[model samples]
Target: MNALARPFSVAAEARLSSADLPKPETLIRIEDLTKVYDPKEGPVLDGISLAIGKGDIHGIIGRSGAGKSTLVRCLNGLVAPTSGRVLVSGREISSLSGAPLRAARRDISMIFQHFSLLSSRTAAGNVALPLEVAGVEKNEIRRRIPELLELVGLSAKVDAYPSELSGGQKQRIGIARALALNPQVLLSDEATSALDPETTEQILALLKDINRRLGLTIVLITHEMDVVRQIASHVTVLEHGKLVESGPTFDVLAFPKSQVARSFLSSIVAHDLPRQVSERLRPSPAPGSSPVLRIVFAGQAAHEPVLAALVEQFRIRPNILHGRIDYIDDKPLGVLTLVAAGGTPTLPGVLAYLSSLGLHGEIVGHVL
Candidate 1:
């Protein structure tokens, strides 16, 4: 589906209060942050609150016009919120002004999807621009430029112009530029959206490397679930302007509660049911029809022999429909869709057994 075609609502379902979020000194905290583009129409970001821990790769995902773009801009004072606070390194930046705001911004840096580098400048020149603007001496700029380029794996391409570099190399330059000030926080505003799948994976890997090596707090805003799955340690799901869900990446992907979260994970874990199965599916089981069930396994439960147990304990054989096993934070998270020969009659026992094993099973549809 086209992201712009999706529906949006300014009215948030349930607001997360500051008290409910993690309060760590080494984190960027957004408290009751709301941004109103047009006061009469309502806020584009509605009282969104979250905490990004130090050295964490936090992803914010939502469809287009979901306020992800505005949220990232707000982090560095490019777009100030109409109400609430954006605390960076324990200092409220929403109200900072002049030199204070400029100093605060030095601790925060951003990279773009478009690889916003000057075509006239070489990769080294672009990375040196930030340090130059800060009035760092030319000698120091020369020393730091090579180090930053090497960090992003673009040392050989330091003298290449933007026009001469590949998509991934240009993005590497962008990453190098964002790190010129040695910012504690790096905001990636859809940094991988324009690249091919392979290149995207490379950029994601580089970002992960930067986070681990430099202990940078990376906040990424994207609509791509695969991007989040590959790198983000934690994730926040947005709808319109409201935060629908926020939690550790594996936990959220394994068992998403909100409509937005379920939709994203569904694309990755559940996908579309087979045409043959879907064509015959109905809300209620018909005579001689089987019931389609979705089973979610995470943590220690993911290692269980669920299908074997189902056959042995309930005396029911499940025909596997669709399934996938994903690794998040090095832990196995699995999802399986199957059809049991018997319908609702055996569901209770099946659910009981799954519960005993700390797994989740839901009847999604019925098919012949």
Candidate 2:
């Protein structure tokens, strides 16, 4: 979806208050996490480790076959790990089994991309299922369902069956059901992937609200960078069953020290261009023109006037072919590609000045 098509309202961009967020300094921890498909195929998750602070909205992202799903499955014992421990709120949950395992799981909740609610059951009935299994009184289930439905904005549809709801509505039902047991943590696996962009935003908003209202720690796995940027306070990037990077979303995104970080940088920075337009960009190797440079301007450097100063001072011309600015936690990071032309002797000075201004320029290739 085009970003300009769905701009945030002034109120929405101000940031919801943080007073209600969780304080679970270490609500969930994956220690030396490793999951192997078998002795034949080898380790699918390799020595991964991370921590989720209390009430933090942590996001895990990776491409298909990156072992993100495998890691999450091991957390709740849905998929057991070959080795290592998963401690939820400081209790080792990965090795638990039988009734103990079931009890541990009650403190954790997971939501799916597909609406896993029963088709014949009403939304209320479906939300009540988890409680029923736990042997909660029927009265308590009835009392809780309405509040849960209202929380996700699904109160009006409580009596409706799954077929009667839209994709987003169905997901809200899933969210309410997952919250049925009032677990300390919430797990969402690609929960908004199937929804439309507008619907996706709504659901994300709901999750953020839930995280705040309930002080619940959330760990979600997604392929969409937009999802990660939207609400994840911290993010872990995975690739080929290995953790490429993990840290606070704003921190990792601001510095982007790894290849995975570079991949995300490319996505957020280049997403603004039409694919065909981007294909037309390149460094020309012809004789006369200056270099085609890719400059990464992070944090405060995003607003520096280095280019203008260089062009005016050196009597050079710069054609800004493409540019984008993305924010993590309301601070901007910028990427700009330009065709630089000037006196050959001034190139080094210009590059040095750009560096001084906090923007790093790479002479990708010569432009004709």
* Candidate topping lDDT: 1
List lDDT for all candidates, in order.
Answer: 0.86, 0.81
Compose the digit string of candidate 2's lDDT tens values, residues 1-368.
36653334322332332335444378888988888877788789999888888888889999888998888888788988888889998789987999999999998899998878899899999999999989999899889999989888888998899999999999999999999999999999999999999999999999998998889889999998788888898899998888899987866776667877667656675423445444554555455656766687766566677777867887768877778777654455677777677645577877887877867776766555
Q: Give the range where candidate 1 is weakest over 10 consecutive residues by summed lDDT.
A: 8-17
Best-fitting candidate, scored by TM-score? 1
Q: Against the correct fold, how does model 1 do in TM-score?
A: 0.89
lDDT of 1 by residue, 105-155 (tens): 888999999999999899999999989888999999999999999888889
Clashing pairs in 1: none
